[model samples]
Target: MAKITKKEVEHVSRLARLELSDEEKETFTKQLNNILTYVEKLNELDTKDVEPTSHVLQIQNIFKEDEIRESLPRERALSNAPDRTDEFYRVPKIIE
Candidate 1:
């Protein structure tokens, strides 16, 4: 089993600005040791023939093709604007 020292746990807690009680520190020490042990076990796996991957499944972009297309005319684009000038939307002044 991997062993985690009380001092190491205390150091980590201090770095994270956590104030843990004695009982909590002991609990965390055991938990961290267990996590290390689990990782050590994983190191025993034979992955020489396995391929490393960022994700388990294949991923591909699902976006539509980026091609030029006809857009709405200016009159149609601004038809529903609550306020507008000749070529732009008009909004209330926000800054002095």
Candidate 2:
């Protein structure tokens, strides 16, 4: 059980600089306690002897097989360039 107390709640509120009304503090205390109780229940679950799996569903690597091929010659590769100089694409200067 997520045991909580008024003093702890008050301390946290003070740290947060929250000017919580008594009613708000009480409500939050109950709500936070419930959340913590749920977490405690989850902690009680038996995870031993369970293999660590990456995902719940089965998935295989979906990719095309790699193949080797000769690359295009530099001259032909740059043939479609808007502007080329010295076998390389050229752009407007940007540095000051």
Candidate 3:
């Protein structure tokens, strides 16, 4: 792979709306080059037989069986509210 240049780093920084110093540009050039080198190394791995996967481990949702249960009456449910009408709790208006 070609070495990452200072000009390329500056161009990327400008595209990203970043104001990088000269030192920062040099540092980023070296770092980006190192990252590309590591990626190139990874390209050498044998992955022909390996299957592509989104995650390393299997995921599953464990849930209890749903059952019908007794529920509180409307009046009992609204007993602790600061303000309520015949059916629903009243809250302060939040939007115009």
What lDDT does the true structure give each of the candidates?
A: 0.90, 0.85, 0.87
Clashes of each: 0, 0, 0
Candidate 3 lDDT by residue in tens digits, 1-96:
557788999999999999999999888998999988877887788999989898777977778679877799888999999998888999999799
Model 2, global lDDT: 0.85
Q: What is the lDDT of residue 32 in candidate 1?
A: 92
Residue 62 miss distance in model 3 (angstroms): 22
lDDT, model 2, position 70: 85
TM-score of 1: 0.43
Model 3 residue pairs with clashes? none
RMSD of each: 11.7, 14.5, 11.4
Best by lDDT: 1
Ranking by lDDT: 1, 3, 2
lDDT of 1 by residue, 1-96 (tens): 347898999999999999999999999999999888777887788999998898877988689788998899999999999999998899999798
Q: Model 3: how far is 6 from its true place, Å?
A: 0.8
Model 1 stretches astray by more than 4 angstroms: 45-96
